[model samples]
Target: MLLANVPITVINRTYSSEHKLISFADTNTLLEICDKFQRPFLHFWTTEQPTLILGINDRHLPNLAAGLKGLAVNHYDYFLRNSGGLAVISDPKVLNVSLFIPTATHNYSIDQAYQIVADLIQTIFPSLTIAVHEIANSYCPGKFDLSVNGQKIAGIAQRRTQRALVLMLYMSIAGDQDGRSDTVAQFYEQGDAYRQDRWHFPKVDKATMTTLANLVSLDISVEAVEDQITTALAAQENAIDLSSAPELLRSAQFINEQATQLKKIQLRNNQLPIV
Candidate 1:
């Protein structure tokens, strides 16, 4: 199951400040209806405002209230993502790419899904020596964290259902990498004041992370990165317009399903006890 042989549907759009959560919900919605298209869907998006995205485990923090208060005090808006991975920064400087693949015909293993995105990233930046491993003291550190010379640049996470899978990558293209790390590290400090959850929360060190702009001489802006990704997948491009595809975004089933997903997100976030 080579990526080049699979059809790709690219949806490039931006989410406003208030509607940022919709971006995630849309991905969930697409994954639910992915079988109807019988192809992979690539969604490229960025948020208008900076947001702190928490993972499922973050909800279980012993001092979750202090964590939420710290975020509010710092003027940060956050939500628990349906996907896995600890808190990650999502702002205009970051470029998020989500690939939703239908598995009705071919089943994809966990490593296969991660490899697909890693391969695409390598293709986009062929000049750099990108390493795939966990970067010590980096936020959201994982086995699939993409790094350059020990400095983490991007992290990948995935959410899988029986019929489909959505692989998400948050690439730090051009921004203050250290400041982003600091923000997350501080959140952990406040969330786990006693450091009781040391093993669960990462001890982020700003030195362990970096942005793509600092690594390559190429134009590493978010827009440029998006263009590079598009070119990398050009062979499998099967562009679709949502306005014309009723079965995808306009059909009754899609509409109801998306609404339901959105409601679930709202309930999850709203039900969290605030200190």
Candidate 2:
């Protein structure tokens, strides 16, 4: 089903420089909202700090310590995400979106969830010829990587609970795409210098990645893209501002549950040796 067919609560969030980790906690809280309220959510968020988010497998790299040290030496903050996919960069210039849909009524297939985000992206940038395929040697390469003229500009990943699914996407809207890719490449190079691990990490190539600004003639800002997205979804009559519902935020149960989820996220991140 198209996204327009579902009623979604829209949330726009910005995190402080030191609180980028809270973004993950917020997502977890939204999952709880999905379970309790049985409502879909479309969350858009950005962080003031540049972060190198590693996936579950990254913690098992043969020389993970050396890789994390490299990131620190380069003045980059790194964390392990409780999700699948290799390392990817998230900064002020990158736009992160999550679509949380409850599956209690409709069992959306994996491909269907991916296609929903792809369709939304296509609606946002109609001028570009978007392709859905793995861009070899690109950071966080996946079958659903959204590319323009063979260079990846965005990637999609999925996380599901018992009753809801969240499709997470990170789009390189405006920034030094090459620098971001190079950082990830170097991390993998240093982390698996010996190449002895059974699981192969990507050998990221900077040329295989491009930002949305580079692919289009228009000047792109995160806010502009966000406005366009909200406008598009609103036109379809599928969006409701989550902030308008003050009762949800003021609920004691919500406050306690969100705090618990945040603590869990903190614990998970703290368990990583890099911390």
**Index of the highest-lDDT prediction:** 2
lDDT against the true structure, per candidate, is: 0.80, 0.82
Per-residue error for 64 in candidate 2, Å, reads 1.1
lDDT of 1 at 32: 77
lDDT of 2 by residue, 174-240 (tens): 9889999989999998888447757768888899999988877448898888878777777666655
Poorest lDDT segment (10 consecutive residues) of candidate 1: 238-247
Best by TM-score: 2
Q: What is the lDDT of residue 258 in candidate 1?
A: 81
Structural similarity to truth (TM-score) of each candidate: 0.90, 0.92
Assess candidate 1 and give its lDDT.
Answer: 0.80
Q: Model 1, range 103-122, lDDT digits (tens) per residue?
A: 77778889988988898899
